[model samples]
Target: MIDNGDDSLIFAPENGKTAEKVQEEYWKVLIVDDEPDVHSTTKLVLEDFSFEDKGLKFISAYSAKEAMEILNNQKDIAVILLDVVMESNSAGLQLAKIIRNEMGNRFSRIILRTGQPGEAPEKKVIAEYDINDYKNKAELTSQQLYTSMFSALRSYRDLKIINKNSEGLKQIINSTANLFQRQNVEQLAQGVLTQVVSILGLENSYYVSTSGFTAAQTSDSDFRIIAATGRFTKCIGTKVEDCTPIPADIVPYLQEAISKEKSGFIDTHYVGYFPTMKDKIHLLFIEDCSKDLGPEIENLLTIFNHNAGIAFDNVILNKEIHDTQIDIIYHLGEVVENRSKETAYHVKRVSEYTYTLAREMGFSEEESQLFKMASPMHDIGKIGIADSILLKPERLDHDELNIMRTHTEIGYNMLKSSSRPLLQTSAVIARDHHEYWDGSGYPRGLKGEDIHPAARIVCLADVYDALGSKRVYKEAWKEEDVLTFVRENRGKMFDPKVVDALFTAYERISRIKERFKDPE
Candidate 1:
C-alpha cells in the first residue's frame, strides 16, 4: 500500500478490468533504484501483480543506504527488486551481501535488475552473491517480472513454514516434559493450556473439564473452565456458558469433539479433546487463529495432547491409590488404639507430627511422607498384648511392663514378612520407635546412629505427643512442662537432631494436636 518515501503515491485497480479483491496479507517488494523514472516504470509494470491470493506492497528506496533503513525496520519482506549501480557500480550487489550476512534475513528472495550489464555481469553476480536471479534491464518484460515473483514468493512461503514448524516441535517437547512433572490434574490441565498457547504462538488459552472426577454426564453444558491464562485467568471455575470471552457458538463444536472423542483443528480454532480414564473429559481451547494455521499444527498438538491426557490420568490414579492406602493404615491403627481406650485421633496426630518434624530436618518430601504413613502403625504391636497388661489403670509393675515391651517385637513380626517398602518401613518403625538414643532403653537397646532415621524421628514425635496428651492414669502436662521435658532429655531419650527440629518447629507441629484434637 505504501509506494514511496517522503512523497506519497497511491495506485488503484483499473475500473474496466475484473479486479482482484484486496487481500489481508501482502508480499512486500522493495524497489531500490536511484532513477525516478525507473521507479515509476517498474511500479507500472508490476502494479496489478498478485501472488498466492495476496497483492504486493511496494517499498521504494533511491539508494543502498535508504534500502538498508527499510530492511532494518521491516522483517517479513518477501522479495527485493534490487537495481545494480545505484550509488556505486556494485551498490545492489553489495546490498545483497548486507541482506544475507549483516542483516541475517535468509527468507527474503532477492532478484537483481541491472541496466549496466557491464558494471556487474550476471554470471559473476549470481555466482558470488546470494542473489536468486539476475535480469538484464533491456530484455526484462512485464510477463518475465510476474514469472519471477511467483517463483520467489512461493519459495519464501515454504521456507517460513519449515522454520516455524521446527521451532514449534521444540516447544512441544519441552512442554510435554513440564506436563509430566505436575503433581495433580489441575496443574497438568494448566500446563496443557500453557504449552498449547506457546506452540500456536497465541497469547490466550483455557482448559475445560467435567466438575466431578467421576463424571456421569457428558454434554457441552456440563463443562466448566478448570484453568486459563492471560485475560481469561478470572474465568477459571466458571461454567463455559458463563464465560463471556469464549465465543458462544464454539460450544457445540467442543461438545462434538467430546462426543466423538477426537482432537483436531476446527474451522478456525484448535480444539483439544482429552477423555480421562475416570470417565471425565478435558478440552483445551486456543483463540485468535491465523489464516495459515491449520493441519500443520495438528501433528505437534497430537504428540503434546497425548502426553497431557496421560499425565492427568496418572495424577488422578496415583492420588486414588494413595488415599486408599492411607485409609487402611489409619483403620488398622485405630483398631489398636481402641484396645487400650486411647484417643482415636492419637494415631493421626502423631502421623502429622512425624511428617512435620522429618521435613524440618531437611528430608525430602517423599521420605517425609513415608514417615507420616509409617507412624500410625508404630503402636501396632500392642494388639498382641493382653487387655490386663495393655489397659491397666495404674503404672505397670516391672514384670507387667516387660510384657508390654514385647509388643514392639510382636508388631515387628506382624509386618516384617511383607515385601512392600511401606510395610517393611512400618515394621522398622514399630520395632525401634521405643528405643532410646543412648543404648539404655528398649527391647533391642539400639544406641545413637544405630537406630533407623525414621524410627528416631518417630520416637521423638511419639513421646512429645504422649507427654502433652491426658492418659487414664496420668493427667496431661502443660505446654511449658512438655517443652521443658523435651529440652532436658535432648540426647537421653530422643535423637538430638530430631529433638532440635521439634523445638524449632514447635509452633507449627504443636498445632497439629489442635487440628486433630482428642474428641470430647
Candidate 2:
C-alpha cells in the first residue's frame, strides 16, 4: 500500500537503519515486462533520471507472478511500468485491478505499455483499471518517457500528502470522540501517545504526564510522567529529567516545542505543543528518528495538535466535573448515614464493593465507575424517614417496620424526577435494592431478572457492607460468618452472580473493607 501514512515516499526501516536508508532513498520504479531487452532498455533510458532530487531505482519482474511478489514485499514502489501482454492478454490489466482492489495500493502510479498496440485493451479499459498512462513501445522516445515519469511521480507525491492529511484528520476525530471514554488523566495520556504515533507513521511511542501537562518551557519537575507506554512503561510518575540514559533525551525537545508553541521535529523526534484554554501548553513528546518528516507531515501534525489542544481543554473540564460529581455523591451519602448514626464509611465501602463486583462480572471500567458513583445513594430515601424509625435501637413494631420499608419508595420519588443518568440510576437502586432474586422483596416486590441489574448489584453490595459493620440492632459479624451468610443467601436474598463475583475477588473486597473501616 505504498505506506501512505505520511511516512516517507521511500522504504521503511529494515535492520534498524531507518535513518540511513531514508537519507539515501530513491523513487522506486518496478519494470514488469517479460522481455529482458525491455528491462535493459527502460533502465538505460531512466538510468540518469531524478525526480524531485530522488533518482529512479529499478526492480525487474519477468512475469505477473514475479511482479506480485515484488509488490507484496516492496511497500514503497512509486511507479509500475507494466506490459499488457506479459503473461496473458489481460495480465497487466488484471494485475492493476489486484493492486488497486485487493492489495489496496492507491499511492502507486501504474503505467501500461505494449509492443503490439492491437493486442492491448482500449484507452477506456485501461483508464477503468486505473492505469495512469498508456504508451506504445515504438512511440515512447526518451523525451516522451521522461515527461510521463515526471507527471506520474508528481501525482504520486500529491496522493501521499492527501492520504496523510486525511488519515491524520481521522485520528484526531477519533481521539476527540474518545475523550469521555478515558477514566483518568493517565489513560488520556496513553491514548494521545497511541494516536500520535499512528498518525506520524511510526511503530511505537510513549510517555505523558498528569501533574505537568504544562508548557515545555518550564522546570523539568513539571513533567512528572503519569502514562508511559512502549519501552517507557517503567518511567511512569518519573520526571523527564530523571529519564536519563534511556537513549532519547526529550527535555530539550519539550522546551523547543513550548518555546515555539507549535508541533515540530527536532533531531528526528516529534514534539507537539498543545496549549489549553487555561493558557498552558500540554506537551506531547514522541521519539521516532526513523520517519522522514516533510512539510506535509508537519502541516498534518499542526492540524492534529490544534484539535488535540481543544481535546486537552475538554478532558480537563470533564475530569473536574467527574470529581465534583463523586464528591457530591459521597457527601449526600454521609448525610443519610449521619441521620441513622452510622459511620460515613458505610457508603464508601458499599460503593467500592459495587464497583469491584461489577468489574469482576466483566462490566466495563466506565460502567463500574457508574456503579461506584451511584451505589452510595442507595439509602437516600432514609433522609425522609423519622429519626425514631431510622435510628431505632430495638426491633420495630410491625406498623413501624412497614413505615420504615416505605423509605425505598420515598428515595426513588426524590431522585426519579431528575433526568441525569447517575440520579436515574440511584433512583432505581433506591427503589429496587431491597428486591430479591426469589421474588420475596419489598416496595413493588419485583423479583429475579426483573430487577434492574444496577440495583441487583447494589442490593448484594449493601447487604455485604451492612452485615460486616456494627449497627444499632447488631454487632459487626465475623468476616468468615459474613461470607458464609452471603454464599448461603445467594439466589435467595442476593443475586447469585454478584455473590460469586465477591468470592472471586475476596482479597480485593477485603482490602476495600479494611481501607474504609469505622474508627474503633
Candidate 3:
C-alpha cells in the first residue's frame, strides 16, 4: 500500500540491478500498422528500451479492428504505437477514442504514428483524441522512436501509480471505523484483520500470541498461534520456537525478520510479523494467488507486511492503555476493602458475581464490563469512616447507624464529578446501591424504576456477598439462610427482575464463589 501524504511508488533499492529481472517479464506493448518492415525495424531499433523499469514484449496487429480486440483483451498492456492509415484513413485515431472513451482505460498511453503525412494532420488529430503523441514514420528514426516511447511510458507509469495510491488510502480510512464498535482484545483483532484482508485483497490471515519476554528478544522463541482464518486453521497452536530440523540459515533469517518487526517475501509465500506478547512476534503466512513468485508480487507483499505491523502495534498500544485504566479502578476498590480484614475479598467477589449475573441477563458486553468494574467501588466512601465505627464487632445503635448511613453520600461525592465512564458508573452505583426496590431505602429513597439499572444489578451482587460472608460485626450465614433472605427480600429490598435472574444463575454463582474463594 502507498503512504498517504507521499504518493511515491517505491521500488526497493536493496535488490539493485537484480530487481529489473523480476519486473522484466510483465510489461506489454502493442504495434498496429500495415507495413511489415515498420514492425521489424521498430522492434530492432528499440527492442532493448525498458519503460517503467520493465522490459516490454511486443504484440503486433495488422488492422485497426485487430488492434481494438487485442487492446480490449490485454488488460496489462502499458503502451501502443498505432499507425493512422491501417485499413482506413482514421483507423488509428478512432481506436484511440475507443480505448480512452469506451474502454475507460485512463492508464495505458496511446501514440499515433503514420507513414503518410496526408492521411491525418498532426495538430487536428492530436487535439481531438486522448493520444499522448503524434509521429511520422519516416521522421521517427531509431533515436526518435526511442524518445517517443520514453515520453509515453513515463505518462503511463505516473497514472498507474496515482490509481494504486487512491485505492490504498481508501482502505486505511475504512480500517479505523470499527474502533468504536468493539472493546475486547479478540473482537478488536478480528476487526483489524478484516479491514486488512479486504483492503489488500488477501485470501486469509492468522494471529499468534506469546508471553514471558520482551518483543524483540523473544521474537523467535515466544510466538504461538492463537487464532487463524479457516484456510489456515490446521496450523493453529503451532509454536515458532526451535529451529532444529529446519535449515539453520532459514531459521536465523526468520528470527531477524521478527526482531526488526520487518516483513519478508520468498516466492509465493509472505511473512508478516506482529508483536503479540511483550517478548513474542507473530508471523502470518498468506498463500499467493498467482503461485509464481515474481518481483512485483514481492513488492506488494512488502507493502502488506509493513501495513499490518503498524496496525497491529496500534491495537496493542491501545489495549495496554485501556487495561491500565481498569487496573487503577480495580486496585482503588481493593483499597476500600483493605479497611476491614473480614472484607479483604468482598469487592472481588461482588465484581465476579455482578459480571456473571449481567451475562446471564444477556446484557451487552460494554454494560457487563462497566458493571463489573464499577460495582466493586460501591463502598468506596468507607475510606472516610472511623476505624472504631467501621470495625465494630457489635451492630450499630440508632444514632451511630445514622452516622454510618452518611457513607452513601461520601461514596457518591468521591466519584460524582468524574467524566470517565468507570468513575461515572461508580458514582451511580455508590448513590443507589443502598436504595430499596419498594421506595423504602435511602439516601434519596429512589423507588422502583427511578434507580439506574446498573445500580440495581450491583445491589443484588453486593447484598448476596454481604449476607453469605462473615463480616467483622457478624458470623457467616449458612448457604440456605442466605438464599432464603435474598428470596424473601425480592421486591422490597432488591429488584425483582435481578432477583429472578440471580435465581436462574445460582449454580454459576456457586462456581464463582468456589473459584475466587477466600483462603480463611
The TM-score ranking, best first, is 2, 1, 3
Each candidate's lDDT (Cα)?
0.80, 0.78, 0.70
- Ten contiguous residues minimizing lDDT sum, candidate 3: 207-216
Q: What TM-score should be assigned to candidate 3?
A: 0.66
Q: What is the C-alpha RMSD of each candidate to the true structure, in Å?
A: 7.1, 8.0, 10.2
TM-score of each: 0.71, 0.81, 0.66
Residue 305 alpha-carbon offset, candidate 2, angstroms: 1.4
Candidate achieving higher TM-score, 1 or 2: 2
- Candidate 1 lDDT (Cα, 0 to 1): 0.80
Per-residue lDDT tens digits of candidate 1, residues 376-443? 99999999999998888999999999999998999999999999888999999999998889888787
On residues 175-286, what C-alpha lDDT tens digit does candidate 3 reach at each position?
5545334554445445544444454452112222211111122243565444445444443445434322223344454566666777655454344566553544655544
Location of the lowest summed lDDT over 10 successive residues in candidate 2: 11-20
